[model samples]
Target: MFKDRLRATRISKKYTAQQVADYLDTGLRNYQKYESGDARPTFEGLVSLADLLNVPTDFLLERDEYLDALGVSVDVSLECPPRRPKPRKSH
Candidate 1:
């Protein structure tokens, strides 16, 4: 899914593979591996691709469905549940 989105976005944005590789500071072969599903970019590379393509990182990661399926809004703020102390053992 990620590979498909990446390729589609690149094509839609009129970016060549070589162009994307240059922007990513990687060799064309390595970039091709990303589209071929043989490799994945690091976290920073993923963010860089999103920024260069003017898309959200979540979009590239295909996380929109998770939000939609869970009825979660982008503005929803979730806090971690508080941890409670364990009960002491009886003497």
Candidate 2:
């Protein structure tokens, strides 16, 4: 599920696998394996990829059934408001 969505999102964004690999600071082979579902990315790696692609993590995860119910298309490249960090409590 993630593999298919990753490939589709990359293609939709007009990004080559090599380009994505470079962005993620990973080898071409490793990135290819990711797209092929032979390997999965770590949580940090997924966050990095999502940042590089300007997408929400959920978009790459392809778990947008709720969005679909609301008639929203799951296109990750769309520009969204910057995420605000949670407030930290003072000691």
Candidate 3:
């Protein structure tokens, strides 16, 4: 799935493997391993790929069960919780 996601995003954005390699400052063969799922990128490389692909890092790396484990849920509302008033001083 990681391979598929990487290849799909790269194709959709009209970038070749060599172009991605250049952007990453890596050898083409090394970068190809990432798209083949034979190797995974280092943490820094993951961030760079996410930035270059214009996708959230999670979009490239996350699985559904991982989301559940993280207890993350999306909220569309922009409202902030109300702040509490200051307590009165005793005489």
Candidate 4:
């Protein structure tokens, strides 16, 4: 569950696995294993990942679905303020 969420969140933010691995200060292989669901990170790693992913550790643990829904609302914004056009030049 954490693996899936991590991969999805990373991809959504246009980050490669290597980038995340670098952020975690772990080998790319280890990061790949996490994403493959073959292993889990240590407590520190989990917290670090949650911080990097901008999600709570509980979300990575899939402890609450409500959090996931709430995260979707906050992590990816739906709208941006409109930009006003520059004033036209006078003749």
All models: lDDT? 0.79, 0.79, 0.74, 0.76
TM-score per model over all chains: 0.72, 0.72, 0.67, 0.69
Model 3 reaches what TM-score against the true structure? 0.67
In candidate 1, where is summed lDDT lowest over 10 consecutive residues?
75-84
lDDT of 3: 0.74
Task: Identify the superior model by lDDT, candidate 2 or candidate 4.
Answer: 2
Candidate 2 lDDT, tens digit per residue, 4-71? 77877777777898999998899998998887788999999999888877777877887688667867
Question: How far does residue 86 in candidate 2 sit from its true spot (Å)?
Answer: 45
Please estimate how well model 2 matches the true structure, expressed as its whole-model Cα lDDT: 0.79
Prediction 4 global C-alpha lDDT: 0.76
Which residue pairs in candidate 1 collide? none
The TM-score that candidate 2 achieves is 0.72
Candidate 1 Cα misplacement greater than 4 A, ranges = 66-91
What value of lDDT does candidate 1 attain over all alpha carbons?
0.79
Per-residue CA lDDT of model 4 for 1-91, tens digit only, reads 6777777767766778899999999999899889778889999999998888787787667666676566543363323334345469999
- Which residue pairs in candidate 4 collide? none
Cα-based lDDT at residue 83, candidate 2: 31
Q: Which residue pairs does candidate 3 place in steric collision?
A: none
